[model samples]
Target: MSGSDGSGPAGRDHPFDAAVALKPADTGDGTYTGATHPAYANMVGPYGGITAATLLEAVQCHPERLGVPVSLTVNYAGPVADGEFTVSARPSRTNRSTQHWSLELTQDGRVITTATAVYAARRDTWADTEATMPDVPEPEAVPVTPMPDEVQWAKNYEMRFLDGALPALEGAPESPDSTTMLWVRDAPARPLDFPALASLCDVFYPRVFLRRGQAMPAGTISLTVYFHADEAVLADHGTRPVLARARSNRFGRSYFDQSACLWGTGGELLATTHQLVYFKG
Candidate 1:
């Protein structure tokens, strides 16, 4: 019997893998088919981070893919139903040191998501990190916060907040600012990689909800991530938890923008991400 998590009974696929599962069939036109997994389901749709990672996965799986992904941007045009979808990935431009790709995810002939990516061949060069990791207790020192059921995606990872948390709905006042720091990684200890890191970037709860002490309808409209480390750097960290810092600069007119950074335990910067979110008060 099939399970709601999109795997057969006795599910063995890792949650991270299941969340990004995509199959390549003979699409004659070089497109691939994908489906949303229940393991990463949100209140109304698949987590935006998972959807973004899946689109990047399509570009990664394309036979013509060049180099390693350096940057990715995903646009959510509409809701993605819990079923099969199609992804089309094509190389838009290629250069000696850089490559560009364009991609789309569609269901029922309706375009629901779009993305663009840039990949680059790495070469030895001068490097520096300007952003310092937050001075907080190590992951092992912090206790895992209880996961609430409504946000199904929260169960897939272990999150220990060092700074910000959702305010109580009953009598708590609004938060001082929309800033948060947390350590997060896959629950069952999956290796850190591009797709996994991509999903982690969006794992933070909507900043508005955290700041206002209210549950409002909120969703990410677009997200962009810039990778600062290579595969070797990520592999060195294994399944170790990464520290994340997210903050919103402005919230107005039904939209807000968020900026975040992910850091390896060794003080290495992994990636920086930004997003624009839509919210209804």
Candidate 2:
């Protein structure tokens, strides 16, 4: 939603916030309605990140939401047509400390996306991060990576690449592996939040682009994000850039797997995400 409600960075109009704005539906079935934002549109549909964030927002705004999201898994069932869509988030189960939710997005009468989320009331506990942020130059030290203008969603994020940038669209040397490390944040600098963090989990380009050094048909089939930071951590993070690292495990005949991690400025593990991708050469 627009930061006008005090949910975003002050005095700045951010398209990312607009892209994720959702309103409760009048159907009285605990559903929400939202329209696609042109600024976040992808080559074929809305950016997968925006869609994921929108789904998470659906849960975050639910009246019965128990707590902050700890885990979210969204499955892309089909292409989302450009237009208005409805989302339904229903609590499937609730425990003393955790809650499970089932979510769906529909356009017209067809299901475009499906998801599951887990929210929990966290308690102070001992925690440590085994995965550390890679040693990279400061965000200011690295120059901005120019994004393809055709990809509308890419314009919403400021990205500075340290390694494994997208290869030439045509012939290019293949890389030994698909590992990308970069610093990214909202283009206009928005405060860190659950929806923003969810969207950041998907900022990486398709692994195939880095591996093959050429663009190919690729799309995420399903994505899962594990939140490690809480509201306090995000509030402390504010509008600073975050370090993001991602790599692919296997590229089979038609599918591949991507694993990624987002680290705060102080090397705190913000979130970990994994996704299955479909590709065609």
- Cα RMSD to native, each candidate? 4.0, 2.2
In model 1, the number of clashes is 0
lDDT of 1: 0.87
**Counted clashes in each candidate structure:** 0, 0
Question: On residues 1-281, what C-alpha lDDT tens digit does candidate 1 reach at each position?
Answer: 77687765432368767767777868655488888888889988899989988988887777877788899999999999998999888889999999999889999989999999999999988978899897889899998885577778888889988878655655767886999889999887788889888998998889998788777899999999999979899889888999999999999999999999999998899999999999999
Residues 51-143 of candidate 2 have per-residue lDDT tens digits of 999999998888888979999999999888888999999999999999999999999979999999999999988978899888888899999
Count: clashes, candidate 2: 0
**C-alpha RMSD (angstroms) for model 2:** 2.2
Off by over 4 Å in 2: 1-12
What are the TM-scores, per candidate, against the unseen true structure? 0.94, 0.95
